[model samples]
Target: MAKDNRIQMLPAEWRASTTLSGVYALRMLGMFLVLPVLALYAAGLPGAADNKALVGLAMGMYGLTQALMQLPLGMASDRFGRKKVIYFGLIVFAAGSFMAAAADTLEMLVAARAVQGAGAVSAAVTALLADLTRDGVRTRAMSMVGLSIGLTFSVSLVLAPILTELVGVPGLFALTGVLTVISIGVVAWATPNPQISKLHEDAEAQPARMGEVLRDSRLLGYDFGIFALHASQMALFTALPFALVDLGWDKVQHWKVYLPATVIGLIAMVPLVIVGETRNKLKQVFLLGIACVAAAQIVLFAGLGSLWSIGLCLAVYFIGFNVLEASLPSMVSKTAPSDLKGTAMGVYNTMQSVGLFSGGAVGGLLFQHYGFSGVFGFCTALLLLWLLVAACAPAPQPVKNLGFAVPPAWQGRQEPLRQRLSAVAGIEAVRFSSDGQTVYIKALQEGFDQTAAEQIISGAN
Candidate 1:
């Protein structure tokens, strides 16, 4: 293949990836829009005033349900269909959002959040993306989904305070319900249903390979790190709003702090990501990110009473978060054997979702008794654990995930084809489906002989 022979999405793939990303973003928007303002609003609600712990549980409930359902929903997609699962999940999510909008009590809100989290379709969406796109363009398509979530978070931070001022928190939840309902229509009308769906090794998890990926020491390190990352995230927000209010910032003015911190954090994140990928310093970058997160917590602990200090701490946290979020998945792919990639990701995603719930639950309980400093102390401990584990983990070699077309005649010849590709010096791992129409590979990017691999595969046919 020529260096300039760029991989491109077909019109259908382009629409599908974009629309699915939008759908995912809608769901995330509902979740994120609540984060910045909910702590403030919940404090005024029933049960929340007497016991702030109720506020934490309400805040984190979605994550608990999301974690519990992610894998099962993904598996369900295989049995029923991707679109069917997605439509059902979206409906459930919308219903939950509306229920939340209607809730007058913290208990009611918590229940609604649980229902919202139950609509976990993340794995299903990834599987559908794999079904829709060829290997050459799949990563880009997936990145679009990830990027959508990050963008959604930023937009929600800005929009939430404005929305809350206009419609109130319940109104914001109602808007989430409405947007999600619209997104369901988008999923139906815009996303092309996959003709055939299977356990996509590159895109979705396989239960059979769980043991291998889970037992690996390095992958476990990343999993623990992600868990800590999200846990700290949920805990921080559980207390941040109150801390800001105490610092004399009004609820509506909260966006002023969040807007700049998020924008600049994302800006600072870009360069760190580049250095990690281009400079082959991923482990060092990962450690540095962990250190920043710890530093952010310490800053929060020390400066909760100061507006500028809180702003700076939030900015640092987001910068670290963006880098780790991008780096961890790539490292997981690089570390796992090709066939078990999805399984590894399945566990990783589970850890992330569960961390949200844990953070909310634990952060709330800690804050209720020990106050803001206690919450920060706990999060600081998590960051410390992540730092220790990440330090011992090996630096990842520079590897990239690549997809190739396999002809129908080669369907039964995976062993020979694997041997042929493995002989290519840069290829690290090769995996083909039972049907053998698509091949996924991890290879050293520096000297990968794409031309030779293409010719040999074409010659096979």
Candidate 2:
């Protein structure tokens, strides 16, 4: 049979990817909806009126629990099955949301947020996505998930304040619980179960390889990058709403600023990302993003007393935030060893969760003592540090993963096949599954010679 080289996803693949992306997006939406208004809402609660630290903890408690449970829940999926784990996680998340909605005190809200984070089903969702898609199209499937997250975040920023005005923070939590329950239904009925659920190293983390992924200096740099990026984001939010209020904008009207800022930032992000990926100038683009974020913080620290000035500063910040958010995982994929990509992502995500926790906790403390200047100043310093770390790290090679089935005859001839494929132009590194069923290649993204590689695979050379 001739190979089907078309890049379009099969109908089933589309269904799987779309539904899974929806499930992931819903879960993320639940978290994001609170971010824009959580600090302000928490401030009004008992035991929080005088304690910005407690409010910050309420904002960040989710991250702390999420960081702790993310890997364990993912590993649980391996043992108990993906759907089972995902269902369990969604239920726990919904329970937490309800708990948060009913809470009357900041302390109770903090515990509820911790419960919310305990769901930690991101890895399982990704693993299930990997299970449902073919190797050739897995990257596209993954991109859908990433796109959903970005869109969810943007929508949340615009909607959170408006929603808070209508139903208040408790209503938001209750709504999240309702949406999460709906997501559970989507998982059971909409998402197709995979016929086989074995591990895919390119998509699922492996415990045995954790040390190797951790020790790589390049991966560590990207890890720190994600950490700083999210930390800065959480830290910024801890004080931004209050700042807007002080500047004479009602909390609900703040969306006017966010709407335009987010739109412009997204528009600006497109050209930079395209140039970076296609032109092989990713490092330069990345550093520029960090600089933009740092500059925004510096502006805030220098004092933006008017809504217009604050809005302009946010536009710059979002440009950097969106670019870094989109590019960091791609950089991680390029930097990690071909087979250890999953493990590297696992560690990278853990660091992100930790950053979220730290930022909220620390930002709140700083804001309580030193006000807006302290919060922005701390964020600026962190980003500058990350920029330096990223600068010293080696530039990432522009490569993408390609997987092909191992022919029966080639199963026992791993070394020879590796050498043959590695000799092919554009193919940089080759790795085989332990059972020799699949061969994964790290090939140049721009001009991978798929036909040549396929011909070699079929013994037609």
Candidate 3:
């Protein structure tokens, strides 16, 4: 069969990717559905009065545990298998949801949320996708996962009020539990198993690379970028629904505000993202996004007196939020070494989880003591720091991720094969799995000679 150079996914790959991606979407949807209304619900719960700190903790408790356990879960998947770990996590997530549903006190709420966080399995999911995919199509597969999370966030925001109105917060929690439980069925029945497990350089995190991943300034830039972005988001949301209600928007009708803002924000994101990827202006786009997020927070703080003002600010905020959210992972993948890709992402996710925790924790603390200005100001400072991080970061190489099948004949002798493939001009990196079923490479320049590279891989050159 003649080799086709254009990027495409196998049918099985697409089925697995989309199904796993659905799992991500479902998880994110469960997490975010409460964001738009949690504050209001907490204030009404028993023992919530004057317990602002615990309430804050309740809001971000999931992040605290998620951050702490993310790597361990990834490593566990490496040992016990990805599906098993994911199933365990999902079960834990469902249990937490039910606990949250049963809680009537703020302290109980926080504990349930913490339990919810303990089910952190994001790295495992990514690792599984890596296990299932060839490097060439990994980015596309990852994007599907990323898009699911992003889209779910927007939909969750819009649905929060509706869900809250129909079922109340506890009922919503119950619904999430049901959703997560359903996903386990989807996983067992619909997801395909990988033929063999291998250490994918581009996907799974390695313990040994911890130092190198941490030390890289470029990776750190992406790290701080995600951290600040999510932190500001969590902080803004801690107060945003309350801010909306203060301006005469009904608590149950908040989705009216979120729908337009989320949609418009997403629409506004397209052009800049295109320019960043197509024009190779990623750094510029990244910095601009941080600035936009800060500016939106500032606007929200200043213009809280009007519903329209808050709506406008949300649109601005989501535009920046969506762009930063979409681009940061891409930057991480591009900046990380192939072997440390998983490790780099693990650290990145930890920062993100920390940001999630801090946003709620710190935002609530400040709001209790200093009012709304303090929370937004704190978030703004974080965004500014991310801006500086982006400014000083190393320029990322403009290369695309590619994967090729290593013919079975060469199987176990991939070491010598990598040695030969690495010698080819324009091939910046070459790596193979332990089983030698896949060959992953990064091209050095634009319009890389894929045909020439394949000839070398086929041992036909």
TM-scores of the candidates in the order shown: 0.97, 0.98, 0.94
Query: Mind giving the per-residue lDDT tens digits that candidate 3 earns over 242-267?
Result: 78878777879999999999999899
Poorest 10 consecutive residues of model 2 by lDDT?
1-10
Model 3 segments more than 4 A misplaced: 1-8, 408-425, 432-438
Backbone clash pairs for candidate 2 read none
The true-versus-predicted C-alpha distance at residue 125 of model 2, in Å, is 0.6
Q: What lDDT score goes with residue 220 in model 3?
A: 81
Instruction: State which candidate has the highest lDDT.
Output: 2
Error of 1 at 279 (Å): 1.4
Descending-TM-score candidate ranking: 2, 1, 3
The alpha-carbon lDDT assigned to residue 347 of candidate 3 equals 88
Worst 10 residues of 3 by lDDT: 1-10
Off by over 4 Å in 2: 1-5
lDDT of 1 at 89: 92
lDDT of 1 by residue, 54-119 (tens): 888988889989999999999999998998899899999999999999998888989999999999
